[model samples]
Target: MTSAVTTDNSARPGYGQLLRTPGALGFVLPGFAARLPFGMLTISILLLVQHTTGSYGSAGIVAAVTGISMALSAPLMGILTDRFGQSAVLVPVVLAHAAAVGGLAALALADANVWFLALAAVPTGASVPQVGPMVRARWAARLEGSPLLPTAAAFESVTDEFTFVVGPVLATALCTGVHPAAGLVTEATLTLLGGLLFAARRASQPRTHAPSATGESRSFALSHPGLQVLILAFLGIGAVFGGMQVSLAAFSAEIGNPGANGLLYGVFAAGNMIAGIAMGAVAWKIGPRRRLILGYVGLTAAASVLWAANSVILLGALGLVVGLFIAPALITGYTMVEQLVPANARTEAFTWLTGSIAFGQAVAVILAGRLTDAHGSAYGFLVPMAATALALAVLLALRAKLAPKAPSRIVNASVSAPVSAAAPVSTSAGASAPGSEAAAGPRDRVNERGMGHRVPVTVD
Candidate 1:
């Protein structure tokens, strides 16, 4: 059986209709609030290190380490959350994360030796995962088939944009302001406050007595061919954006406009956020693979603008345009990942999906930093752009097999084995969307991880 969709019935919304029901509004706000701390933490790490250590080299290394910790932690945590429930697993990790960051702040400000500063980073860095993704995943399960989800996703994308865009600016302003310590303190406080609130929310938990027999089975993410392709795509996309983070900061600083880094990033997020909302209101029936190819192509074009731009304004404007594709690409990719995997291991699948981004980001930070240090930041954008082009070409060639051909695409292009409009689309072969009459009790399948006891893997 497929996951259930959450319906918000308060308002019968038309075009550009977002937050149709009170339930959706309820879900969306928590998702937004949950994201704030993590988003703030992401940029805060960069600013905090720079402010405390007084070295960009140190700052870059700390950021890279944080990425590594986050990548490592996300999948495992997601797996636990999937099986045991988010509250059972998420709360303690958040507590640990809060302690780590708060404790590290003391060390950082005390001018603890460089070694102590670096050492403290391990836990602090590992603490925050994209809480937004998990939050969105919950929303996905809650609001599956309803038109509300896409709109919810659109709002989620915008909130994410705000988080990344505004998060750093807010942190920077606070850190440099009268308090100077306010940034990290605020981040810590929110993580505690929000994480606790999330943990306490009854609706946040999935409605189930036991693991779906399918969910109870376990498997390694790598062996799944669809997951493999998704990971590769994630890595490439992650690399591109990761490079942008480092290169943008350095690029702005080089031009005697380091402060504009957040503004440019905000513009980039703005484009994606606005476009995401717009796309949400319509029917998006494109095959995941074709849409993916489109997204990569869009990114390539966006990067080209960056490589060719004459001014920061041009770069920011182009960034905004390119940003449009980011959310859609990611949303489509997550949907594909959910379809291909199984009833269990869904959380792990998403975790790896995110991990790929973090890994790519880490690699980008390390490699891009060195590249920027040697040549100008302008030269730094080349690698990720080329990588995106290559990744898109590969996915397109494999489109027919890994991703199902869309109903619309099959009609226009000759194809067999097309899923019809009336056909009940099973998550696997016979599964229907949640809240549908067609869905019945699930038949458990064998989930082999690498080949296990108590190994539950859902394709979410």
Candidate 2:
């Protein structure tokens, strides 16, 4: 049995090899930097709305609206990127985001109509996905089947940590010190710059899914027993995160130290980022399936601790402890998603996984806000914890009934992929020929029952 699977496309860069090369890290840094400003924008909006409107309730409404809109649009954008390519899709989206956000910033300064302000919010908010998940996808295929992939996951998570940590501090400072509008302007500028830089990156730019890639794989991704469980787990994860956002924000506000809340959120991200690194460094000797089960269970345990106490300090502390498990769990699940999905739908599969995360974050934010309004932030913790716990139990119960993760990689086909001057094949709603026929290149469908894209090893 092969210990590791290699992709059929030798031309594709491995994540491990890319990092080893000089300047590759530098190449990816801009994408990371682009996310920093927006982090501040999110919280600044929350604080600004609360202060200006004198309503934490209104702030929650705006926050929920923004988070949910982004969540709803993300998969669509992912699908667009998968269909149209990142450069084409994200460029226009980012530009629209810039205009919308800039309009909002200006509106904050001007006495703009309230309805107009809300109108602008939606499009600006939609712009967020430009630099986030899609950028991660760019590197995913580049680093497939290497230790670097986990390291890459860690790196991606770190950017998320940095964004939350830095963005909030800036938002808080600008809101209290200068003007709320300053934070908005700062966010607008940063998001525009980051989005532009990321979209412009030649390699990082999103590309359309090659047709013939997945003409036959949607059923597998949607109906495969293992995948179904994973998707449900992700849906629950979304609910947990959505709840966390509202709960954390409200909790911080109630304590009269909103700064502390940002710190707590930062710590939450930090724990995951750090753990993700360690998780990536060590190769799980166990199979991907076993790794996923352990990872999810760890997440359930870590997240549940928030319910034990409402003490701000304690929650923060527990949040960090819980966050420690998050990145690893996500990375493991992402890898599992890759393994479980058919290659034709790899982009969509990955999108589904990422979309689930965003969805979880969105729903959690909305629920947490409402729950905080009705009860308290502390109680909101139960929202995500309970949801995740239930999802886990259900997934576990059904795990055996679902197809097990293929113990070892399998390829029953004798196939060869073509190189240059690739022929283009169009696909339709129910087409399989395009994806199947195109399923041989670096663009080949991920083998659901296989480890990943496999290149047979020959012993001389």
Candidate 3:
């Protein structure tokens, strides 16, 4: 049963084929637009703070605060979205996010206190919609049991890579060429427009019916073993990537071509994006664990080789190699998380996955920055190498924990009935047992928390 559930639709499809799926284009494109700001916001804030306060240190602090706030708030927002409808949750969040960005821009233009800028970043970061997670959940719900899901996951990674790849370059250009405020203002505008467009698409939203059982369920996602290890693995990978970014920039500057930093980063992203595209189009017999373990080893090997290269060309080549492994790791990790948690828990689970990566990157950037300053730029490579090695070690030691339980054995087993791929999975905590509920009717019955009866829990 587990094998059937996990491996349904074994035929591999072309990367572009997933777009032919109903609602695919609508979901992916606007998600790309809203996420453009995710790639741009931190850098924009960093530059804006530096320009206003005339201190790189102060700017770094402000950026860090914003990142941490976003990471912490993401899962909370995901939970809320799962409970309330997407439009109900998303519209208000986008409005608040836009207002926050506006405040940051105004303060920067006025040359306000650095602390004030930092304070404004708190809301700005907290208000960012968990678009990536929501969209991924939607895709999984839409394409349940199809071979196309892995492809969709791969395409999702590429879209993310595209935004990050281009976002920094675009932000830097707007801030430096047009005005400091231009970058952030643009970020806010796109975020609102893209977010609203996405929210309006009711067809793609996942359904969360009332759970027939509830008290036995755990609200926190980390309670499951599979999720625990997966989240840790994601954090480690993020640290390596983050440290690599800082190290590469420092190295480029050392080579007397600071301008080449974006290009170098682009080379790395291109490798990841290209590899992701190819991987999606092929059939994979291997499970997520094997791919994940191999990806860690490849990343570590690629990052270790960076210290030996003095030329930007060699570094770029090695960065590309490192990038090649990133997508597989991410695609597998996300797929595994989806399988491990209940449908109701997916939004928060996905957000936690993303947040872990962001947290890892934030910490990596700070530590790597100090390491480069103290030991020269070459030593910065050690940061990624060490982080990757740690990830490899943990995945190996905890391999058994990551092996997923059979679908029939999930905590809410009775509630795990298969539904049509076109319909959204009910994520409600109080959903009725699958067999009983399906016997009752095709439509799902979602119980709101305040309903007048004791919520029963679903168990395998």
Candidate 4:
């Protein structure tokens, strides 16, 4: 149970170890299916509404509504899952989501009013399953107290990159090649099937915490100072994604290659996937705050180059550079949220991260669309640059507060905590490190099943 903050891939478990965890695949495969629609929905809706209504402005509004709804609902769903367990909540939510998608498709096909389409987005977005957060929570629960936890987190980041790479392309192909309605229909079908399969995997489900145990007067997870900073920072990152999508789409259309947007984005995801896999396998000595700052720097620097991209080839090449920091940033954030809050608030805390990104993206799309529509695609890149700059500033200002405190020495401690590569190992008094029983108070050490576990100390 020794810590490996400075260890390389040779010292860590192989990628296979992530799947070898009991019941890992049962949740992961369906989770992937459920998440695929995230990539599809925004672009598909953008194209579909724009095509039918004859205006990108109308399409952007509807899409923005959908994204905002999804973002707003994330924390609520997280609370629900934390209180009642995943299966109990997922069944109803997923079915309702499928139904909403069906209605949205029918309305789009019938040339319904633009406001009517926006109305449909409310339920469609609200019903998005807590799949991403759930999958991460499941991994944390299963791998609780294991040194391999960070490795698992990295694997999940890679999975996310892969989904983004394929999901948007799939959406675009369905909307363009097959039929406009095809993308929405496929999204609904996949979500339903995946949600059902995920629900059936009882073995992999994480333990649930009753909200009442925290007492009615307890502060929400976001009330914590560090978590607040992280959420705000993530908002900037989300804006980066949202603004880039709009810019790429407009740029493609301007270049007489509207369909190339998905491929360009895929190039972006490919770079992220490659970097994410390697990031997960290696161990780091630097703390999470430093890594987070570095990621911000890299993302901003690479994204700044987009303003100069006049051709699709240049955009594709720059996409790879912009993607390099995404995985490191995301993986580190997830790992930190796991340790920053109490065990009971784990799911809800993660959902806050999701919601932050959603809100940021929602704002970005709305702003970027108008910017691109008024000026040109070239101006659209400015939105992400501003967003990343703000993020970097936030991290720099809060670097000391956000960094984990050094861990305290213990006499013959039984458990070693797992450390995310993005975060440094805490060794000071009251330091909060992942899976550290000493760092977590008595109530925080208990599992969802009302059982307490001892800390597994590392020999090294």
Candidate 5:
């Protein structure tokens, strides 16, 4: 009988190839628009609240509350998405977010009390659509078992960094030049329109799996020990962001150029975007776990000297270095989910990592703001250093936990015959039998079943 099983020996695809995948732009564009507001929200809230209240302390507190709320709510949203599908969860969440943000802006403009503003922030943050996690989940579903999975993860991070580059600059300009509330109003508009557009792309959304007989689908992403480690690592990264946002703004004001806050933060985010782009292009030999650890080492080293920079040029230069090292760790953490979590729990896993960053940022923003107020902007710079140091220590101690519990397997599909009749394929790391049509390339192995392809059987 003619064998229907064949191996694919194709070289790994690049970003261009990944983007060219059919229907990619359908979700990518809308997802980008929806998530751009993520970069803007914190800064917009900080500036608007600080402007109205004339107190950085109150502004920091309000922003912190928002971040904390979002961090807490993200996984819950992920659970809803995993159960009901993305469109159903996103529609109401986006609408609620727009309304909440609008109310917060109105109250800020009306000189509402800090306590009232804090209360409004709860709903505003809880309603922020989990767009980033949703997009990542789409990519995972679309590219499962393909070599381009890492590139997709890197591309997502690049997209995130690009939004940070533009979002802060746009929000700052609107708040400073147009109106104190303009930044927030624009944020709300984008969240509403972009989120609805993203939700409308039903074709690109991942299929929601029904709960298993054992209800394994109902388990939380945080139940995984590896996921917990990743979340803690991400919290450190969030601290960098939170520390940078507040400290950089304070530094700019202290240097008699408050308007330069956007430019400075933009430079930092640009560095991050650049690094992400470069990371996606390279074919690294080291595994993701090693890359993650090394990335943190570089980050901690760079962040250590940030407090000593007394000049704008120096601070910006140091900030750029810090940004440069962030992408590898961030991208690796996202990429690791493929091995660490099952397909059913992937979205929730992504959100936990994302939320931990927000939580870390929330804590750092409050602490950094108080330090800057009490001492100086230089003191605020200490937060990233401390956070990174602690994260690095944890990663070093628990490095083994990051390994996958089960070996990833390559699924061979029979194109011409039923998969059941095809001979069992080797799980080893090379070519099939000598006369086979193609060879199995390393890194092309993944446990992606039920992908709507003409697959006969999957080997465990």
Candidate 6:
């Protein structure tokens, strides 16, 4: 019976089961709306600053400054969320973000100095809510020991890709068809309203606990060598995003149809979303660590040819391929946090990964923008290829560090059974244990804190 159950694909829980978990929809809906601005803000800034300054270089600098600020501040915000709880940290942050966005838009429209615009960007980006990470933390808490954790990670990635699809299109349409500043205004509005609504879902927010007696709380997420590798790899992914955004816009402008930037970007993001959906649905036999390396290799391969795409159709097709390969890498990274970090630091860990992407994007945006301005949009494509290749090398060198430092043990409370640390947990249905890399699903088991409930625990 156990063998039959393990072999039967139908026994695995689907996305519907994951979503039906209590209080999931309450936060997921508002969380989706809040994060739309994540995709909008940078593009809107690039377009608006370019419109005002008449230089892609200048626009890129401002956008890059914003990305850098976000990268620097995200982990700090995560620490606050972990210490003070999500709603308490988010309410003030969102309010500040809205105000800063308004000020940045005003300065640009008023033809303020580039330095002033850049300075204003600091607060704007710093205060932008880390909605994506927060939401994922909530999922981590709600589905801690469940098999649905990987599905949740994939679902969040899909949500992110969907927003990217809609955000660029909306921002581009508003800026081109309505007014240059319209996109920024709309982005600010959504950030404020959606952020507040998402913050108000306190019932679903992860509980923030006080520090343990051992002073374990002082440990930062980056202290883990494995997490550092993941961050570096994600930075490369960020380069892909930054490279594509500027290059796509520059290409569209070069072709005498600037409005097409949104459409092209949308197609790229649609591929990512589709892949996320597929990744979540599959019961994978391969480990996430191996899957991550494979996904990134494919992404790097697809990115290598982006410089050769001269036509809109060709660029879009190449971009689609790049997008398809990115989702697995991203989902795997997020899923791996459960095994690498303690529950208390999971939120901060997620933010570190996110911040690395922002930092990478910032660097790429400036490089790509200058390259596009000097040579052409085609030259900007080199950033992602080089970045991914370099990151892949780092990942390969540190591949051994990606494994969990300690073996995971499952304690079954119903029967008071103690599973061997070196062996897989025996489920009645013979399903491979949640944390085991060999499981026919994504490995997402976290170190359970207590012994009362049946959970996987990893002792460091």
Candidate with the greatest lDDT versus the true structure = 5
What lDDT does each candidate get?
0.65, 0.61, 0.76, 0.76, 0.83, 0.82
Summarize candidate 4's per-residue lDDT along 308-423 as a digit string, tens digits. 99888899999888887777887788876655665567788888998899999999998888889899988888998889888889888876566433223220111244333333
Sorting all predicted structures by lDDT, with the top scorer first, yields 5, 6, 3, 4, 1, 2
Judging by TM-score, tell me the better candidate of 3 and 6.
6
Model 2 spans > 4 angstroms off = 1-18, 21-23, 108-116, 204-207, 210-228, 252-259, 310-313, 342-344, 398-460
All candidates: TM-score:
0.80, 0.76, 0.85, 0.84, 0.88, 0.86
Candidate 2 per-residue lDDT, tens place, 1-460, comes to 1223333333232346546644456447777767787577667767766666666666655665666566566666766676677768767876777777677767655755445656666776666654666656766655443334555666666667667777778877888899877787777777777777776776644345555654732333455566667767777766755676677877888878876766777777777767766765563445555555666787788777786666777887787777776666666666655446544345555656666666677667766766777888877888878877877787678766334344122222212222222333222322325454333322222222122332322110
C-alpha lDDT of residue 288 in model 2: 50
- Candidate 6 residue runs with Cα over 4 Å from true position: 1-10, 212-216, 254-260, 409-460
* Candidate 2 to native Cα RMSD, angstroms: 7.9
Model 3 TM-score (2 dp): 0.85
Cα lDDT of model 6 by residue, 202-292, tens digit? 9998888558786755556788988999999999999999899889988999999987887788888888998999988886656778888
Candidate 1 lDDT, 37-82, residue by residue in tens: 7666656766777788888788777767878888888887777766
The 10-residue segment with the lowest total lDDT in model 4: 443-452
Sort by TM-score, best first: what order?
5, 6, 3, 4, 1, 2
Q: Judging by lDDT, tell me the better candidate of 2 and 6.
A: 6
Q: For model 1, where is the 10-residue window of minimal lDDT?
A: 443-452
Per-residue lDDT tens digits for candidate 5, residues 1-460, read: 2232222222345788789888999999999999999889988998999999998778878888999999999999998898899999999999999999999999999999999999999999888899999999999887765556778999999999888878877998899999999999999999999999999999999888668786654656778889989998998999999899889989999999987777788778878988999888876666778889999999999999999998888888988999999999999899988777767788999988889999999999888988998999999999999999999999999988887664423343212222322233334544355643223322222222212222222211
**Residue 396 local lDDT, model 5:** 93
Model 3, span 120-150: residue lDDT tens = 8899989988899988989877765444567
Off by over 4 Å in 1: 1-18, 145-149, 207-216, 219-223, 404-460
Error of 6 at 309 (Å): 2.4
What is the TM-score of candidate 6? Answer: 0.86
